[model samples]
Target: MSQFALLGQRRFAPFFWTQALAAFNDNAFRCALLVLVAFQLGLDDHAAAIYTNLAPALFILPFFLFSASAGQLAEKIEKTRIIRWVKWFEIAAMVIAAVGFVMHHVSLLLVVLFMMGLHSTVFGPIKYAILPQALKSAELVGGNGLVEMGTQLAILLGMIVGTTTMGAAEIGPWLAACITIGVAVVGYLACRAIPAAPATAPELKFNPNTFGETARVIRITHADRAVWNAVLGISWFWFFGTVLIAQLPIYTRETLGGDNTVYTLVLTLFTIGSGIGALACEKLSGKRVEIGLVPLGAFGLTAFGVDLYFARHGVAPVRGLGWLGFLRGAGSWRIALDLMLIGAFAGLYVVPLFAFVQARAPREKLSRIIAGNNIMNAVLIVAAAGFGLGMGALGFSAAEIFFAAALLNILVAGYIFTLVPEFILHFFTWTLANTLYRVRADGLRHIPEEGPALLVCNHVSFVDPLLLMANLRRPARFVMYYRIFNIPLLKFLFKTAKAIPIAGQKEDPAVLQQAWDAVDAALADGELVCIFPEGALTRDGAIAPFRPGVEKILARRPVPVVPMALRGLWGSMWSRRDSALGRARLPRRFRARVELVVDAPVSPEHARAAALEARVRELRGDMA
Candidate 1:
């Protein structure tokens, strides 16, 4: 089903609107305040700058101070109740904001700014934590994509509406006040319909000391190296976005020589592209939380970012061009395409990371981990602001800053990928598998979502492991013949996947023993291990005798055993079918139709090699 279907479901629709409206109100109020200070208040430039600068700092301060507490609250209290309270808090803030707007009370508006920030700080944990509970494993990525799409569009609309509403002649302030409060109230009503998401750690002790709790949460977040790096990757995304967005206004004015209409057009293009990309995740990922897209996203962000600098780096000769006028000018299309792709890639980058964190983190501690992510995001956003200012201070053009950020993305992505090679490994396998074949996987649910499982599959081709890796919802370690595992070109991928390399007892008894020990250890540690019981690929398109290795491994670990089969691969590239002189033939057809069929998992006691081979043969049928 399309991810959009979730929007029509009671489980998702209400919460979606509540969060979207809150985003709208947050941006609308902030933009209205900016319009007031910059254009309406008639304050001098220096005074206006003070208020403008103070606003973000004040808003971000709450995240640094209260995120830990908010995380704890989300963990201890039922999520819907907290969300309702947060919505009420937003209404109260808007009430104060309404007064502040009518009286032109800068101090009061700033206070409301901080209040909205606090509101977001409190809502942040629940926003993510609730999703995993509400969504099935299949729905997690789609759900996150929907939320992200809503947020981007909401933020864009809010900015446009707020700016336009507040820019009106006389009724602007009152209108802005009315709109924010109304949105807040509607958000509260929407949130009331959100289904209850019970706390994950209700029986756990709550930590009240902000500093101590913050430290503890951070430590917990960092406990998993992959999760921690995902958090850092997320932070880097915020940093990149902050710099890109902060420069857009100036970029529109000085570089593009466009007025506000053009600015809005560019912003709209970016946001819409992001929405499209976010909504595409479920389709592209095959309804799975596929991290392979992260590398793809990182690549696009850097590529377009550099291209954006070159598309139009210098100041435009014409000034005050309207939206249509800007489009009519030279190179405008390139600039627009670059911005749109940048946003699209950003969507691809972030949604998976969020889902990965949700799927991988300990359920009970997930809220606190999300809080830690928020704290890191805030730090990077602040740093990005500083980066923009410093670059501008050094007389760098907006385009130069873009160039610098793109280059920095390369370094950042490299560092993160190095720290977690699984991302790169997944990317390689995902790309290879998707390019080589159209895969239809059935009965993936038979593999347990968590804990140890032994997967036995018929060996079909050289890329069997990659195919399975790409299709399996959960990660699994492959046990492969040592020669294949040590293939020079594929060595890195095999090592990163932690594939156990086995040798025949006659060829290398030591390696065989080590492989046996590794398989047992991995199972003991609660991980999935997949092995091909055929021992060698069949030269003919027929079932081969099942080796006794699977039985031996079961004897050691006794994990649940799942039988799997790969169909339509016997004649594909890298299979032995068309081989001559000990080499396989090139692919005769691109994107061959392939299917991974998994049967119900068998108990270890019943999962003998002959039985698994019979089941796999039954599953494969005459397809091979």
Candidate 2:
């Protein structure tokens, strides 16, 4: 089914709108308060800074303190009913905000902000946990993409509305209050339509001790390396986003010299870029839960962040120009563009990480895992604030700080990717294959997560192995021709992947021996080893008769042999028939929808070359 079909279904749409509207209201109220404290109350510069920073701290504080309790609530109760109660609380919080605004009471407003944060903290686990319950596994990525896109756009609109309404000449406070209350009401109504989501862990007990429960939750999450890594990835995104958003006002005033226009512009560009990047996940991921996009996002974040620093440094500050004039200004435009792209890349970076966590976490404990993620996000955001403060104390200009942040991003991203090589490896292969041609896969579940498995497939493209490698949940060692393994541009990739290179006996006896030994060692270590039994690209666009070498390899180890097929690769550049000079050439962009169909695993005793070949051919069907 298509991704958007989820939106039309009863299970997802109401909750999606409810969450989006709540996000919108939260930002609108926060921005309105910031404007009031900055301009209407006649606060000093330092006081305004404290208020702005303190607001986020106060809001996020609840997650750290109450997330454990919230997680238990989500796991133990019906999610739809819990969400209904959360929405009612949102209404109560908004009512308080409206009162505070009308009274021009800053203290009361701060209290309301904290209350709102607490509301969100209680809703956090349910927000993510409900998705897995409501949507199918395949729909997770697209559903997350839509949620992320809607969220960023909502944040942008809320900030625009809040700042605009707060700065109005007359009745600004009243107008802000009315809009905030109205949006809250709409959000509550949306929540009312959410379909029932049964409790994942009905017997889960409540734990009130914050730190103890937090530690327990972390311990449980750590049992699954992939899920824990994804949680850390999500936390890092919050760190990056917090730092960027925190600097915008400074970036606007000091760098661009526009009052509030530049502030809104930067925020809008970043948020919109994020939205675009988020939506692009569906296309880039090929409608799968592609965690590879996480590393891709990190790369873009650092790349664009570095460029933004340089771009801003090169720009001569525009003294009096408004937002439009600043955009038209000579170097300033580049900085603007850089900010937008950085945000876009960030969107690309974070959405899939969230989906990966949702899809991989144990079903019963998903809510607690999400709660743990929220707690970590809160911690990272707080750390980001401190980092910014430290940078400022060292007498760094905002531009210099931006550069420092960009450099730091490289280190952090590198560290995360090192801890999780799958992300970087997946990014590499996905980028290579997607850029070269459309890829499709089938029967991927036949590839065992552990133990020795020989994957025999028809070779149709130079990148076919990489595509298969990228999609598999576990790392795989591929046996390839010596020359392709030595290709200069792809040399580092092959080395990093530890791909085994082989040659025919007449060409290179030592290389063939090395290849065989490597395959044996990999299988002995209980790792998956994939071999293109065809040994070369199909010259006639048909499965070459299976070679006896596969039979020989299996005789030694007697491991499971998974029969697989690749379709729609015959016309690819590497296909023997497609080459103009009897060599591989680049194919058209996204033209073919390739598929990898994996048949049931065949035991070594029963596996025969002809039998495996015929089974694969049947799965490949008329596509070949």
Candidate 3:
């Protein structure tokens, strides 16, 4: 089923709406305040600028101060209770905001903004930490996609409504107040429908010190390099977004020389593109948490950003054109497409990273880790603002700033991917496996989600390890024949993947011994290890004799043994079937059909090498 089916389910729908509405309410309040400060506050330009700019910082400040505490609370208390309380706090904040609006009290309204920020900080952990508990592993990416799409659209709507309502001449403040309060109440009602989310760590004592807790949570987030990089990736996205969004209004008015309508049109295109891209994650990823998409997104961001800079490079100013008129203007369509694609790529870039962080973080500390992510995000957002201001101070135009940000994106992406090669590695493996053949994997659920297991598959071809690695959800450490393991172009990947290489006893006794030692160590560390029971590739398209190396490994540490087989690879280019440079193997069947068939795992005590060989042969059947 498509991920949209989640929107209709009780388990997800209400929480989704509650979160989306909260986003809507936040934008509504913030935009309303900005409108008031700009048009009605009657302050000097300097003072007005201070309030307008400082408003966002006030909102973000809470994330820096209270996110650590909020994360811990989500871990200690049932999440639904927190959601309900947060909703109540939202209502209270809105009420205070209403009085601020009616009485023209800027100070009261600023406090209201800070309270709303506090509300969001408390909800941030619950928002992400709840997903892993609610959805299956396969659904994590799609679920996040839907949430992201909803949030993007909600923010758009709230910004439009908040500005429209508050900017009206008659009863504007009261209308904004009513709208905010109504959304808050409806959000609370939605929270009632959210199912109970039990505490992930109930026994953990509270850390009353925010600074110490912040340090501790950040340490936990840093414990895993991949997760920490994922957090950085997320933070970079916020920085990217904040810079672009902050520039859009000025870009619209100063560069395009268009009025409010044109500004709204560009923002709409960007936000809608983001929502569409978010929804596309499910189909693009084939329902997996595919981090490779992050690279694709980064590429798009850089490419389109440069294109956008050029699209509007030297346009002369035009006055008060509607969105349609702007479209009719020279180079406008290209500019429009550029903005939309940037937003879409932003969606592609961020959704999977969020899902990966959710999937990989330890359950007990998931909330705290999310809090760490928030702190990082806040810091990056501040940096983005400073960067943009620094660029503007250098007298760069908005288009130049866009170009600079785009170029900076390359450096940022390069740094992150370098820090963690798994993304690029996954990109390579995903591309190669998807390109070479159509692989069908059966009984993948037979592999355990956690802990050590021994996978025994009949050796098929030189690329069997790659196929298995791509298809398996949990990572596997492969034990391969030393020659194939050292294949020149692939040797680097093998070592990076930590594959164990071995040779026949006569060829290399030391290598064989090291292979066994590695297998035992992997299992002891609770990692999956896969070995070919038939140690050599079939010479005549038949299963080779079972090797006793597997039996030896299992003897050292008894673990679950899963038997599997690769089918339809006998005549592939990588296979040894018709060995005249393998040209005879290359006809008609290019991108051939291949299958990795897995069977139920057996206990190590019952899993002899011969038994696994027989099982794999049975699974392979007549495919060869």
Candidate 4:
């Protein structure tokens, strides 16, 4: 089985069920209480509205109040132990929920909601931090995707169960109570299967004062711009979700003229879309934490959200239509479809931000940083609620609100792209190259993290430099021939990349001197400089003899030399041997797989052209 398959591994299954069960129980209890107050109990409309609003507030409140302390607990204790304790807390919360249901007490139910929030608050840091420990580095994206998909599915099922069961007179509350308790027990069992995840920061000092510690954690997040940016990205997702979910009841009742079923259908579609988008992350990202998808997701959100606004304008209010009836209604299905696609794109937009935070944050304080993120998310959600209410008060329709949010998403995404140019730049390059060809890279770890290094690869295809550029985390200055460097369409890219251009000694001595000086300067500044040591692309798909100039440059810098080989690029349309006159007759759809094999780094004293060539040949193996 593929490593990306969640069910194939013990490491992920436990945590997956644990998180899904928590989401299900939380929503089930909330929806059941809302149903009782709104329908069976015959509460006043104003009171019901207050209850509905307060339900979310109570649920989100603990994330702000207790997340800082929870972060501390997660950092100081083994995650498995913390998770077990949290599961017990869930069981207790469910029991309290059962009492609330039995007594028909609104106050008790509200209190239970708050308690569930607390349960989730304590689990938040552990939920994210545990993955980096339990999963392999490459599996992080896929694991996060599965967890997200499962959580959204759980939300959908919970809503369905809560709404359907609450209306039954004989077994409504009893069924809900049984489901809640059973799910909690199952969660506890799943927690038992989780392998031990030791605390990353056992020496962390715990503080009881929530406000002060919370402020301190927020400060730490702000100190790292990348982490804080990711936090903002996550918070924005919650903001969008809060608006979308909050408006569902209003849209279903006032706009669609439908009952509870329509509300549930809308929620289900949106959530299912999110699950699909989350699952797509693994395949789209090639199992890496690809931030490039964030921009693509942002684009889709704006496009579909705007389309959904227009779609909603065409939906007529329904009267007592079942699921199939609703699907057949004019524009109702289109609206639902748009909502689902918007949600899926939103998932695509957010999952990478989460992975980015986990991969990039200081491991010692990841929990606290995640706690800080929770605080921001809570604040943003509250802001979203306020924004929606304000918009409604100002006579804006739900469709208009969506339009405004979608437009605002464009501006916000633009600002973030500006702050992190790499996000947009990398996204552009990665999308283009990945769509055009299948790229396989090996021995990428040979690239040193914090030193000057020389990378020598056999040039094959026109895009070889770009393939290497995209996969390697470090920025490299490629030394290219003058003609290729000045290629009409690629010159801007080369200039932006600061590629060095050289000519032969007899052709242009001045250009050659400038190239040498640029290479020396880049190495002195601790940059990795790459060159096709074969001098030019091979004419017949064979590795050319190693050029001696690379040795001379390495001798001056005395840095490590990394040998890399590019495979399966020989037959590409962009290969040097491709006939220019016959280019129009080339195969229309070339789907070749290319691999970049990086051999172990060799020190200047130990490496020569012959040694480097031999190592490259070995890494290439059959392809060579």
- Quote each prediction's TM-score: 0.98, 0.83, 0.96, 0.87
Q: Output the lDDT of residue 105, model 4.
A: 86
Instruction: Choose 2 or 4, whichever is better by TM-score.
Output: 4
State which candidate has the highest lDDT. Answer: 1
Highest TM-score, which number?
1
Candidate 4 lDDT, 1-624, residue by residue in tens: 254576667888878888998899888888888888888777889988899889989999999899999999999999999999999999998898888887788899899999999999999999999998887666778888888988999988988888778878968888888888888999999999988999988998899999999999899888888778878988988988888787777777666767767777888889889988998987777677788889999999999999988776534545666667777777767788798999899889999889888887878789989999999999999999999999999988777788899999999888887776656766777787787778777766678855699998888877887787777756689999998898997787787677999998998999999999999999998889999888887777778788888878976778888889888777667786556556622435755567888888888998888878777777777773
Q: Which residues of candidate 2, in runs, are more than 4 Å off?
A: 44-50, 314-318, 440-456, 459-463, 471-563, 568-612, 621-624
Q: Compose the digit string of candidate 2's lDDT tens values, residues 1-624.
A: 666777887788998889888888888999899989999988899988888878888898899889988998999999989988988888888888888888889889999999989988998999989998888665778899888988888888888888889888778998998998899889888888898899989987788888899898878778888788888888988888888888777777777777677777788888889988988888778666787788889888888888888776533445655788787776877887898899889988899999888877778999999998998888898998898889989988777777888888888888888877767877878777776656666666666744688878878776778878766655679999999899997877787787999999999999999899999999998888888887888877888888777888888888999888888877677667746676665666555677878888999998888888788788888897
Instruction: Please give the lDDT score at residue 562 for candidate 2.
Output: 89
Model 4 spans > 4 angstroms off = 1-4, 314-318, 440-455, 471-531, 535-542, 547-562, 570-593, 598-607, 618-624
lDDT of each: 0.93, 0.83, 0.90, 0.84
Name the Cα RMSD for model 1: 1.2
Local accuracy of candidate 3 as per-residue lDDT tens digits, 306-357: 9999888654467677788899888899999999999999999999899989
Q: What's the number of clashes in each of the models?
A: 0, 5, 0, 1
Residue pairs with backbone atoms closer than 3 Å in model 4 (clashes): 256-317
